[model samples]
Target: MDGDAWRPDLTSPVGFVESDSEGDLEPSDLESDVESVGTSVISGPPADVLEADPAIIVAVGDSAISAVAATDLDVPVVPVGDVPGLSAVDPDHVSNALESAFSGDGRVRAHPVLVVETPGGGRERAVFDVTLVTAEPAQISEYGLSRRDESIAQFRADGVVAATPAGSHGYAEAIDGPLVSAAVEAIVVVPIAPFVTRTCRWVLPNDGVVLSVERDEDPVVLCVDDRTVERIPAGEQVSIAADGALSTVVVPESADGRD
Candidate 1:
């Protein structure tokens, strides 16, 4: 096992996508990502998972590609190849990364995945770095929330975000969400394109934080990860919490490669 990759249960690949070429990622340009396990299971795109059981995903593409792929598949990915946001990863060392990851060799970092329930009585979960809730009308909208049953925030804006620490560095940070230590058990909540200048982002503990789009007649969408096609209609209270830990990859200290 390599010294740099963390280890988690790898009994089955919830989903795995690979690209033979480099540069930018286009899932349609690559071969099918799904693998055939047996007569009971078959391989396909992320939308195929609605009929399949939930499983961990290994996305073999750049960060942007991997993020969308993983989000669609509804699982976390062991990013392979050239991923942008996942800096310092050696494309050549991917094999070593797999070995260390499956063998349980590197440091363990846990990321909380978000669980969303719809007003239509449908439930879906996302292990994305960030989940964005925006207005369906494509205009400014009203936002509401409560933490542990206590009213904390309510405002009008384009949308709001609930991101895991792993996501804090990306969209969360771009929206001015504070980047907290990934090691900490916390969730960052930020108002997206808020109407009020005083609106701010909050780094709350990952326990009982609930956020919702308070509009019912006017619809909104919950964009998981970044799969616009997989958007969920957000007219109901969507519960956000630490449903489970997403196993994050790290280039082991022992493996000689990029950071």
Candidate 2:
């Protein structure tokens, strides 16, 4: 990941709402604050936001930020609520964060997005990770990993996860995966529960990596970020690569200082 100083025009800001009932903050209250700062607020769905093409996007919560990341839009995102991976200001400080961003006091960090291609010609983007796992619980399946036409390893496990640096801190870290720096362009690959006592986890290059379901007694599914996209049968291949990046705003005081 790379970062540059970015100061967005706050004259027109878009508010992307996922859920307003989480904390004490409400959508109406946020709109009033935006107006108080002499900025126009446009609130709608992701598609509407894309169409509106506002100067900056204000994500209200974790899911809103995830939704903005999933859109793959090349816009600067200022997270206002509790968002993971990147630093976010509290609900009470939304107006201050926007003011700082408008005054060139924020840095724009580019977070890599994972592009997952299925065998059926379908493609999806994930800001965090892509997972392949058995459809049923505690079911072991055979999976093969490779990169640039070279074989890496084959193992039996409940599932396998390929996570980006931003995602490496979440589920991947819980499974003892390495914490990759945001400055490094790498993918953290880890097996969920390997049959062998000691299995290997890899931090591979971000491109040209392929995962195939070698053998499966049960059905398997492919997940992009949070939701299951489709079922992947045996003998099919799934390719992942770092296609583009998401621009996220990191305010001065809200910086978590974590890679």
Candidate closest to the true structure, highest TM-score = 2
- What would the TM-scores of all predictions be? 0.65, 0.92
lDDT of 1 by residue, 1-259 (tens): 1124444443443443444455443333222222222112223544553245534434555433334334533343456554323432354554455455455665534456665554455545544444545545457767777788987888887878887665676677787888765566778888888888687678888767776767644556766565442343444566676766544455362222122
What 10-residue stretch in candidate 1 is worst by lDDT?
33-42
By summed lDDT, which 10 consecutive residues of candidate 2 come out lowest? 14-23
Please list the residue runs of candidate 1 whose C-alpha ends up more than 4 Å from where it truly belongs after superposition: 1-15, 18-58, 61-77, 81-92, 99-105, 129-132, 135-138, 216-218, 228-235, 253-259
Clash counts for all predictions? 6, 0
Cα RMSDs of all predictions? 6.8, 2.0
Q: Against the unseen true structure, what C-alpha lDDT does each candidate score?
A: 0.54, 0.80
Query: Best candidate per lDDT, number?
Result: 2
What would you estimate as the lDDT of candidate 2? 0.80
Error of 2 at 22 (Å): 3.9
Q: What is the Cα root-mean-square deviation between model 1 and the actual structure?
A: 6.8
